[model samples]
Target: MLRITAGKLAGAMRGALVGNSTRVAAVRSLHGTEESAEEFDKRYEKYFSREGIDGWEIRKGMNDLLGMDLVPSPKIVEAGLRAARRVNDIALAIRWLEGCKYKCGDQMATLYPYILEKVTPTLKELGVPTLEELGYDKPELALKSVYDQ
Candidate 1:
């Protein structure tokens, strides 16, 4: 809360601060290595498949999954979908698929099919319809203006 300004006082304060500084340029690794993809998958799968998971938790988990830069592994996606099913939110599950599609970018054509292939059996067992089945593969209610037509 103290602000030392100008002249000799400022110089002395700056010197004291720098001398007492405990900050280090080198930081130690907590785990010494990054989490392996398998560890990441198991962690998220456990997170979504925990007992008594609710809609909010499912949404939170989905948001976390989407926020990550990498496309989630199929097991993680299946676990999240199953969590959505546990909460009885078909809409959320569909949105999760959309997020996954967004995460896949141009690779969707290649990756999504495989993701679907992996999760299809689970989707059938859960009775959750995909965005395509719900008619969301195309934009909703496209109207061509007469001027443009």
Candidate 2:
């Protein structure tokens, strides 16, 4: 399950990663309001039932992963797949992985091949950019700090 995997991944990366768990807060900010678990679930189900999800949804999910500030592991991917399978929505799962890629940035480089293999066809049909195409195939290490004077 995603919860289990997320927990383990978080545990493994707690000291190694650099982001914060701001999804809950970010969600509330993005929505301009707080939502209860049931409310969120209802909204999520409705969103998933649509023919397609928008970039905002994907970005929000990515922000959540970014908040964790950890690189993704294979187990994390498996957990996401399992969670999506529970809903019988393969596209949604792929979308979630896309979000993971954006959220984790270079940290997801190792996952690009696996993710591409799984979602290439669907993404082509859907006209979504592959992670590699989007320039996520490698880490983007800055040569200079933004604060450099």
C-alpha TM-score for every candidate: 0.75, 0.32
Off by over 4 Å in 1: 1-33, 143-149
Candidate 1 residue lDDT tens string, 43-65: 99999999998899889888988
The true-versus-predicted C-alpha distance at residue 9 of model 2, in Å, is 46
Best by TM-score: 1
lDDT of each model, Cα atoms only?
0.87, 0.55
After superposition, the stretches of candidate 2 with alpha carbons farther than 4 Å from their true spots are 1-66, 107-111, 114-149
Clashes of each: 0, 1
| Winning model by lDDT | 1
State the lDDT of candidate 2 residue by residue for 107-138, as single tens digits: 44566566556656655555455445657555
Q: Any idea how many clashes model 2 has?
A: 1
